[model samples]
Target: MRKIYVIGIGAGDPDHLTLQAAKAIGRTNVFFLIDKGEAKQSLVDLRERIIRAYSHPHKRIVEGRDPDRDRTPADYTGTIADWRHRRSQVFEELISEHLREDEIGAFLVWGDPSLYDSTIAILDEILERGEATFEYEVIPGISSVSALAAKHRVGLNRVGQPFQITTGRRLAEGWPEGVDDVVVMLDAQQAFTAHPEAEIYWGAYVSTEDELLASGRVADVAEEIVKTRAEARERHGWIMDTYLLRRRPTTDD
Candidate 1:
């Protein structure tokens, strides 16, 4: 039977790749990478750098597009389900062309598979439909949350406190109740505006030389971050950013 290995490549730093992830890449017969068009060539370039440094000669690289799912609808869950379905179709087509029953197919994920990533979900759907019979494994890599904390020199949570991981859309809807610390991702909406009472530590292209790091009251830095993010996206044609927000404790109950 064939086996699929989903390896997290980490946030940006190639050194963040775990030994196990590198080993999996080296053993892969066919490795698939996603291309978000020419505008985001850096992503593909970064993947190539990692493969060149670690992948063996026997391993072949295949490029594919991530499914484009409509997100304008309020149905976040349904959007993701449809997105995963489309991704599974792309994976099936790619694997059919190169994967063999006895060979190992690999995919390099951006950050740990368990985190906001949907690659594993697509694979699961494929397996559930009996479209593919393959053993699967996910090798964890450094997450953007860890990278953000390290870059900002702050722990994700305070002593005995809990934190939440959410997306920009939810934040725009409203701050989640009962969470003091929140790590926000996929924030195209600049949701920081909704939480004026929070402090923000934001980073764009973390761990890369072009990184932009800023922190201060969310209200103070919200516009700056929005403008900077736009400029950076215009200059680079793409951006991957994340931020941490902590609700300041007020004296009043």
Candidate 2:
């Protein structure tokens, strides 16, 4: 039987790789890589560096073309579902062809596999089709949310209060009910700008050398954040940022 590992590689820093993750890499016979093109080559380079640092000498790497999707689609949910289905097909083919029975293969995921990542779902989809057969395991790693809070030295939620983790799209829709502390991810719209009263602890490429951090009331720092985010995105041709927005207690509260 074939065995697969869905290993979380943490955010971006090489040091983010855990001992367990390294051990998994060492035991892996083949690594499946999805090429996201030249603009995001840094991601591929980082993975290569880790594989070189910890993988066995006989390890093999197989690359697959990442399926393209609209960055801003009219129907975001449906678009993502379609994109993921296409992506699963790609992974299915890669596993069926490159991975041999009785060998261990891995997909190195960014951040924890159970977060906003789709690797696990894709694997499940492949299995459901009765096509690819394998035993899979998930290895957790530090997420960008964890890295952001650690770098800023702020707790995600104030004592005993709950914090909600949500996407930028939902944050833009409105502040979530009953949660004053909200963590936002995959926010291309700069949704934090909408809440001028909230205090934001923001970081881009957290834990990496090119990391940037900012904090203050959104009213005071929203412009700066917008400008900086634009510049960073332009500089890297892509950006991954996460932030915590803590709304102050209002007079009514």
Q: Which candidate has the highest TM-score of all?
A: 2
lDDT string, candidate 2, 63-164, tens digits: 999999999999999999999999999999999999999999999999899999999999999999998899999999999999999999999977767889
Candidate 1 lDDT over 1-253, as tens digits, reads: 8999999889889999999998888888888888777888888898899999988876788888977777576887888788788888999888878898899998888878899988888888888888668888989989988999999999888766778999998888888787788999999889888887799999999977788999989889889999999999999988889999998643222
Model 1 / residue 162 / CA error / Å: 0.4
Window of ten residues with lowest summed lDDT in model 2 = 244-253
- The candidate maximizing lDDT is 2
Candidate 1: Cα lDDT at 146: 92
- Which portions of model 1 miss their true places by more than 4 Å? 250-253
